[model samples]
Target: MRALFNDRGRAALDAAQDFCTTDALAYGPLRSEDLTADGSSLGELMTGPVLGPLTVANTVGFTAPVAPVMIVHGVHDASVEIEQSRLLAQRWRAAGAVDITVREFDFGTELVPEFDHTATNVAAYPEVIGWIDRLVARA
Candidate 1:
């Protein structure tokens, strides 16, 4: 039982590392401590690290033709807040790019009940696929 728990702990750590690495890769190095410190709001932290890339990504509108942009975001995500994706969706809509969908889930972090940092996104994959299907079928 101890071994099983150990393995799970390691897996969770690995997932977190991967998540951080991916973010840095996309948006560049972040003052991770500042973002995680007490009294630091997620929205404030995201203003630079996340929103900067989003602005660039949406500058010319989605070139793929209303390709049913589906953002599977964890509502309680600590690394990246749902508001980031929510803002993205809103920008996409403003760009006249219809058929964008943002889905939220409750599984990501195990240690922090409020932070869903784990990759339990598979739980919402089916519904996300259906959303994409409907968007694709639209005129």
Candidate 2:
């Protein structure tokens, strides 16, 4: 998804970028030595305030919407793991969402490695359109 960043969003992005660069330089490159060191800076980066909070928030159970929901995830997506969508589907089912479909496309079957995030809209365009058409027909 794309975000229309206003002033606050831009400021947050700038701050995150600055923090990442500074941390990377201070900690040096990610190596076995660095990871197994006394204080794991890479570990800190992974569990830091920015990423940690988002990770927790995503996994936390919440009341799902009372509407038909379709979740599509690429099996080989490196950016966002497929488990994210799986967990979301679980939460939706628990929250009483009746018409929820969780679709997964294997690597190079219905998705491409290069278009990890946009595979649903790009490589699987026809399937997506067909899904929407079926949903509309049901409605």
Candidate 3:
């Protein structure tokens, strides 16, 4: 997901924090495996507003861990505005996210150069996998 949607993510988090609740959309860096169980339903839905339901993690209330997050984005992403990730990184940090990494790829000879929304998935796979592995190890 784009994380923060027109500041709604921020608003939701703020409301929860003020109300002493935990039902807001908890920011997370989703990986492919995380969506396999949905049979690619999420794949089709992510580009649209259908994932709105996922904004609430648990209806009954559960405290999602403020896990370390890393947003690997292509500066030239066609589907999502780079600003969304930037604002999300900022908001998540302000909300007490201890570890937030925004690794961006521009149009140079750097990692994932000539980046695009879908290209990032293949170009940055190794780095993304490593980050996930590290997080899992910590867990």
How would you encode candidate 2's per-residue C-alpha lDDT over 27-108 as one tens digit per residue?
4333422332234344454465555666567654477777777778877776568888898899878987788877887765
lDDT of 1 at 63: 49
Q: Please give the ranking of all candidate structures by TM-score, highest first, separated by commas.
A: 2, 1, 3
- What is the lDDT for 40 in model 2? 38
The TM-score of predicted model 2 comes to 0.55
Top-TM-score candidate index? 2
> lDDT score, residue 49, model 2?
59
Using all chains and alpha carbons, the TM-scores for the candidates as numbered come to: 0.47, 0.55, 0.46
- Put down candidate 1 lDDT per residue, 1-139, tens digits, no spaces: 1122244333443556668534434444444333343434334534556555665565544443355577788877776778877877776787787767667786547665432444536577788778767766975
Worst 10 residues of 1 by lDDT: 1-10
Q: State each candidate's clash count.
A: 5, 0, 0
In candidate 3, which residue pairs clash? none
Give candidate 3 misplaced runs (Cα > 4 Å): 1-65, 108-115
What 10-residue stretch in candidate 3 is worst by lDDT?
20-29
Highest lDDT, which number?
Answer: 2
Error of 3 at 124 (Å): 1.6
Root mean square deviation (Cα) for candidate 1: 11.3
